[model samples]
Target: MDGGVLEDEVNRARLVHAAGLVAPDDAQLAGALSASDDAIAEAGRQRRILAATLGNAVNVLNPSMIVLGGFLGSLRDVDRDAFDDEVRARALAASAENLELASAALGADRLLIGAADAAMQRLLADPLG
Candidate 1:
């Protein structure tokens, strides 16, 4: 839920159903990314949200790359181009110029890797360990 585009699919389906354009709990919702205009629009909106959030971070942190992990890593399947464009537009021009947006190479193992990293840091800090 904390991941940006990761939690958007459910909301997209809900909005589509609420508009009466689709049936709730229907199979069509599974394919909404490809078949529904509303779903695509929702994805765009979510991507914009992600872009804005990242842009703000870029302004403060100036990170050279932003790796989208978890569900957001799958954004390439939904709207990678739009998301990239939005980030470029919203971020500071200098920060955005050489910025790289990439999917987490660890895939589902990102959390595991993070935990391992924390454990390593703790072990290194504890002299008696």
Candidate 2:
């Protein structure tokens, strides 16, 4: 539960299959490097994990849509479908109906961009706006 340990875990997860070092201070560049270096395979792995996990969830609750963000969106079609199939096979039959998965329309910075949008929305909704 130490802060350093938690941060290390985060970094390790981020860079588990990374081809190079990825540090917190260099996360932005690391994100880019990740996208350029192993985005496809990594994304496929993630998708497969998600699919299998969701498929195995008790009672089944497959997401109607899956939005691949971060470095994952850049993956090619073949990898995408493979991941989709992995998830579909595990997903509940009814839950898998009409399921859709696609890369984020925004690029690598979608998370940051989304945070900005959320902040702006929260501010605009505030009485001070």
Candidate 3:
């Protein structure tokens, strides 16, 4: 999954949450980031919610490998563990076989790196090679 969440502060103590899914072709994952305390808290809350949603989605997909990318892709172990647990909870037993969950290899630059890598790979695979 590729996306980003940004929180915004509407007032001194109030905040607004804005986030969305990002497509591979999207140039930027721009959004609002809250400075307010509540907004910050809301961002955290939304992060967890997103983690759970991702876990559930992965469970549903049950792919052999699951790669998490985006702003929060580099979350700490605890956060990653929480996401994994949620994914497992929602996934079926058979689907969990050899499941690999890890941070995105490209970190925050995955999209750019992936594009370059693809280009290089294609170039290498060309008949001209």
Q: lDDT: which candidate is best?
A: 1
Better of 1 and 3 by TM-score: 1
Per-residue C-alpha lDDT of model 3 across residues 49-84, encoded as one tens digit per residue: 655665566667768877755544433232567667
Write candidate 2's Cα lDDT for 1-129 as tens digits: 234432333223554445344443233433443464564354445445455554565225556887755444443233567766766677677877677878777664677899999999999899596
TM-score of each: 0.59, 0.56, 0.52
RMSD of each: 6.8, 6.4, 8.5
Model 1, 1-129: lDDT tens digits are 455453453344444553346553323343454566766666556566667777888888888988876445554346677677777788899988998988767865677899999999999999587
**Which residue runs does candidate 3 get wrong by more than 4 Å?**
1-40, 75-78, 127-129
The candidates, ranked best first by lDDT, are: 1, 2, 3
Against the true structure, whose TM-score is highest? Answer: 1
Ten consecutive residues with minimal summed lDDT in candidate 2? Answer: 1-10
| Stretches of candidate 1 exceeding 4 Å from the true structure | 1-39, 124-128
Task: Compute the lDDT for candidate 2.
Answer: 0.54
